[model samples]
Target: MMGGELKRMDLTMCTTTHDPAPLSVEECERARLARDPAYDGRFFTCVQTTGIYCRPICPARPPKPENVTYCTTAAAAELSGYRPCLRCRPETAPFSPAWNGSQTTVARALRLIEDGALDGPGASVDGLADRLGVGARQLSRLFRKHAGATPLQVARTVRVQRAKRLLDDTDLSMTEIADQAGFGSLRRFNTVFAEVYHRPPSDYRNRKRKGRGSPTGHRALNPEPLRV
Candidate 1:
């Protein structure tokens, strides 16, 4: 009886290990090199030269194999000290399956976040839960488990992207941009943008132009806040 129990346990462990989730580092590199959109949400790739990481389908030229490192999540990469890519906008990329792999509630929460639900004035977990037909506590649990970011962190990231887009694309005043980008104030917007992107909005815009006049005398697209 003891022997049979031990065999069953070993078999169960083997099955569990063999049936593990689909996460591929080599596959991620192949997808990055191929610029395959199918794997965009599945993995992130970091370029050693730039210190910035991007989704697999980014339009920028592919880095050499020796120059790339695969990252499982944007947060993981950020935690490892990589900055988000200006070209790919990892924040705006589709939510990872890991975020929704276990719970429908967390998945929906992420979708809502992408839609700018939590960005504007007075957005709250209670209101977010009411819309999702779930409780605040449950929503928090999902964010903690999958996103590696609190609900507020997710929302704030989205807002920063919005601000960055405005800063780079339009000559909007900081105050106007802040309001349109869903920030409570220009100070907050500037602070957050500087923190995440490592440059003030003005500095980012200048660097993007590099003192060259715009081709059409109009601002260039940031390409970072791609919504489509």
Candidate 2:
């Protein structure tokens, strides 16, 4: 073990070696220099010179290793007050954790939601936080720092994405889609889906399977919440 036990990364405060232990510094640096897509989302390259962070595959000119610091997540970098790269959009990086350590709060919350923690009419942020052993307010703060959305907003995005998939690949009706997507009512679903994607839910029904994305070519879930 290179350092001590892992703990919550208080990225909202500071970035230093004394903060929670990070991934292998040597490995993160090598991957950044290589411009390796394989390392994308595993870690981020935070440049002190530019006060910006980027994906490993970011096409912009690479910063000197001395001017760079590695962060395990976009939220960490952002919470530490670094902006996300305009070209790479670290928020949208594909996630694939290379370490076998504890999952970050974001990762765990996402896992729980994917496993149906946020499903059904009874699901709520307080319930999810209880499962994660954190308070609702704290969990929401973590999400907003890292995810650029509140826990409910994250769940709403998940529902909309699920509904979009159902619309594209399945023959489900509007009511069915709303119910399956975990909205309290079909009317609520329509209103939220339109607000987020700027299109009514029915507008996407039976849509072609090709090039599935928003007008900006980003996924409906992330919605270009670029924290730049």
Number of clashing pairs per prediction, in order: 0, 0
| Tens digits of lDDT, candidate 2, 1-228 | 112211223323334443353456666667777887767767777787778889988899888866777677677778777888989888774544423112387779987886668878678888998988888888887787777877676777788888888887787889998988888799999998888767777764523332365576655443333121
| Candidate 2 off by > 4 Å | 1-103, 206-228
TM-score of 2: 0.45
User: Worst 10-residue stretch by lDDT in candidate 2?
Assistant: 1-10
Model 1 residue 150 CA deviation (Å) reads: 1.3
Candidate 1 lDDT at 24 equals 50
- In candidate 1, list every pair of residues with a backbone clash: none
lDDT of 1 at 26: 58
TM-score of each: 0.47, 0.45
Q: Residue 58: error of model 2 in Å?
A: 38
